[model samples]
Target: MNRQTLLGYVYAATGAALFSTKAIFIKLAYMERVDAPLMLALRMATSLPFFLGAVIWVVWKAKRDGKPLPPRRLWISAILAGCLGYYLSSLLDFEGLIYITAQLERLVLYTYPVMVLVIGWMFFGGRITWMSVLGSAVTYAGLLLVFLKALPEGGHDVVIGTVLVLGCALTFAIYQLLAKKFITVMGSLLFTGVALSASAVACIIHYIVVSGGVDFSASHRFYWLAFGCGIFATVLPSFLVNAGLSRVTAQSNAMISSISPIVTISLAVAVLGESFTIFDAIGSAMVIAGIAIFAVADQKRAPAKRETLPVEIEAA
Candidate 1:
């Protein structure tokens, strides 16, 4: 591979690893009894300035190049993508985290690749091949094993958490579908910047409406955790992966990102003192296997009419 491609792979892998840390930080924030809305608000609030700065720069660059401003429709897409991808999905994930282990949460959330495939087939009239179907089946079978095993110990919490995170994955898949178009039109940086800005605004508004207002007197430790998540998990990894994706194929990015669940699971076990198990190993293997299968299936499928989902994976 060329240096640029190799660098892209490295960047993608590193960003994915960083994205895996997002859950860990959020889980840490929750340990402080920070409400899900409040935590999300803090994260988005902390990151908003950065996104705003980037948006301004993008617009300035466009003006310098004498390019027209992005249309209103594009802005609308950004807003919707932000709300669907980050604000709502994040809120659901956080709520679920309150009830479940981070390991399970990561594994569940990692299924978005599959979600993308299925949702595309269902909504967009995209064709699904047997390989993709089998890949998804293997993935879910592993998920079922891990999930069922989780059930015996956590009981209702596991089910509730799984449903919530599943909601997160589903909604994010929707965002990916929607934003893919916006990205093509607006470019990754502009689309991502605008979407993040809108998501931050939505997060702030949602928090106010739902919780009445922010509690400024919360523990400083929580702020640190939220800040870490805002930068390390949200902003940094996102742009990093976006940059890397610009240099590499989506397949390469996806394959590199497949390591994220393992990263999250290992971190959860080592840092959070979560238990590790044979079932966890088996299930995680299956999830990875499924993703590998999906990637291969995607590659082998007829390409002329595939309607082009980008190789760009979300670092959100």
Candidate 2:
């Protein structure tokens, strides 16, 4: 791989590693009976201060350089991105985790890429290649295996959890695609700041509505961990991924970042003492293989096609 590609791979790998810690932290907080909305509110509240600081610094630097501030349209986009992408998506994810195994939860959540592709095809006239179809099939087959295994052991809650996780995945996918539209105009720091702030506001509202009031004293440790999760897993990884995307193709980034599931499952098994059955292993492998195939096929089909015209020809 070229230097830029290598850099992107490193950044993406870092993001994936950080992201893998999300489930572990959530599980830690959940063990204390911290409601999902409360935990989410704490996370966003903690991260908001840091995100705002970054925004201030960025804006000041731009002004120092005599650059114009991002326009109102970009800010509006940022608010929507934050509310839906950060707040709603994360709330659903944590809520879903309450009902599913950590591994299963991660597996379902990672389906965002598939959702992105499908949404693109439906909304933007993008073509869905045969390989994408096959990859999606394989991925879903893996998910089905896990679902079937859980159904017998988990009873009714398993189905509910699965549906919740699927919703989380869909919402997250929408966040990604919609955020892309504003990234260029607002830039990453500004976009993230606005979105995260908006998400924080939404989370606060949800927490109040669900619990009747904010209860900060319920679990100090849980809140602290949730705050750490927001920083380490959410903000830091997001920054890394955005930086990486600037240097590499989405396919390469996706392939490297797919390691997140492996990390999450391993942590679940080792730290959480959760057992990984044979079927789980097989299904996980299938999911990884499907993602690999999808990324490789996409790269092959869209190989960096760049052309340069002669100066004389360009004048015409």
Candidate 3:
């Protein structure tokens, strides 16, 4: 690989590694009796200052360099995207984790790429080729295998947890689509900052209402771990993924990301002492294969295209 491609792989790998810690931290906080809302609220709130400061610095530097800020409309999209993508998805994800194992949760949530394809075809007028359909079917089949394996051991509550986590996945898919739309106009730094800020505010409000107040006095270690989640998992991974996109095709990125479930499963077994059965391994393989097929099919059906329309035509 060339220097750029190597950098892309590094960035993508970094993002995946950072993201792998998410379930670990969530499980950790849960062990501390920190409820989902409280944990998510704290994570967002703690990360806010850094995000805001970064936004200010980024905006200032842009202005100093005579770059134009995104219009008011893009800011509105950013806020909505942040609310739906970060706040709603995270709330559901954390709650679902209470009922499901981290490995299972990641498996269900990893269905977002398939969700993205469906959403794109349905809403954005994107075409769905035969390969896309076949890929999606295989992907869901793998998901079904994973779900079946989990069900016999998970009891009735697993069904509810699965639905909630799937909801989180859907919401995140919407967030990705919306972010793709606005990222160019708003610029990644400013856009991510604003979205994260909005999410943090909403989470804080929800935390207050749910808990009757905020208190981190019980354990500073958990709070610090939450901060680490924000920095390592959220912030750093996000930066790396964006940086990686400059060097690699989305297809390549998707292929590399298919390894995330395996990483999560292994980590769960190692760190959380969760059992890893043969079925778990088989299910994980199926899921990764499904995603790889989907991505490959997607690339074949719809190679990336450059827009010929003027900026105004493209603007919403």
Candidate 4:
């Protein structure tokens, strides 16, 4: 590979690995008795300023280039997309993690691309080849293995958690589909900055309204965890992934990101003392393999049909 390509791989892998740590930090914070809203709020609070800075920078650059500003409608759409993807989807994921292992959560959320494909086919006249179906089936079969294995151990909570995470995946898929146009017009960086900042504000408002006040009474460790989530997991990985995209093909970036769930599984085992059974092993492998197949098929899709669709889902 050329130097740029090599650097792209490094950036993508590092970003994926870092983003994978989000669940571990979240699980640890939960051990300290932090609720989902507060945790989400704190994380958004911590990350808000950086995203705001990005927004300012993008605006300045746009003006410097004599580009017209995005319309109010596009800004609203971006904000809505951010709220759906980061705020709602993340809230569900966080809540689900309370009941399910991080490994399981990651695996379940990994199916969002499949969800996107299905949604596209259903509503947007997108074609579904046999390869996509096979890949999706295999992916779900693997998830079933993991779910069945954990069902006995976690019982009702596992079911509930799985459902919640499913909701997260679905919402995120919708967000990806709907946000494409806004991302195109406003540019990814600007749209992302505006959306994420709006989501952060929404999260803070939700926390205050739900809890009757914003509580910052958590332990120091919780603060550190929040910082890790906000900066390392959320903000840093975003830029790293964007950087990787600049240097590498989207296909290569997707392949590199396949390591994400594996990284999360390893961290959960090491840090959270979660078990890794034969079922978990086989199931995780299947999930990754299935997604790989799906990604390949997606890339092979008609270029015209692919124009309106996003290639990958954003990380939580």
lDDT string, candidate 1, 1-316, tens digits: 8998788888889888988998899888888975888888888888899889888999999999999987998888787888788888888888888888988888888888899898998897777889999989989999998999899899999999899999999988888887777777787777777878888888888888887666544688999998998888888888778777777767767778898999999999998999989999999999989988988888677442312232232334
Predictions: Cα RMSD each: 2.3, 7.0, 4.5, 2.1
Q: After superposition, how far is residue 175 of candidate 1 from its true place, in Å?
A: 1.1
**Could you tell me the TM-score of candidate 2?**
0.91
lDDT of 3 by residue, 1-316 (tens): 7998899888877777677778877887778784788778777877788778868998899899998888888888888888888889888888888988888888888888889788987898878777777777777787787778888888877898889889998888878776876876777677777888888899889988887776645477678777777776676776677677667777777777776787888888898998887877777777778788888887787676421110100000
Summed backbone clashes in each candidate are 1, 1, 0, 0
Sorted by TM-score (best first), the order is 4, 1, 3, 2
Residue 74 lDDT (model 3): 86
The local distance difference test score of model 1 is: 0.82
Instruction: Identify the runs in model 4 with alpha carbons over 4 angstroms from their true place.
Output: 302-315
Candidate 3 regions off by >4 Å?
304-316
Error of 1 at 77 (Å): 1.8
- Please, what's the RMSD in Å of model 4? 2.1
TM-score of each: 0.95, 0.91, 0.92, 0.95
- What C-alpha lDDT values do all the predictions have? 0.82, 0.76, 0.76, 0.85
Model 2 spans with C-alpha error above 4 angstroms: 1-5, 305-316
Report the poorest 10 consecutive residues by lDDT, candidate 1: 304-313
How far residue 14's Cα lies from its native spot in candidate 4, in Å, is 1.1
Clashing pairs in 3: none
Candidate 4 structure, TM-score to reference = 0.95
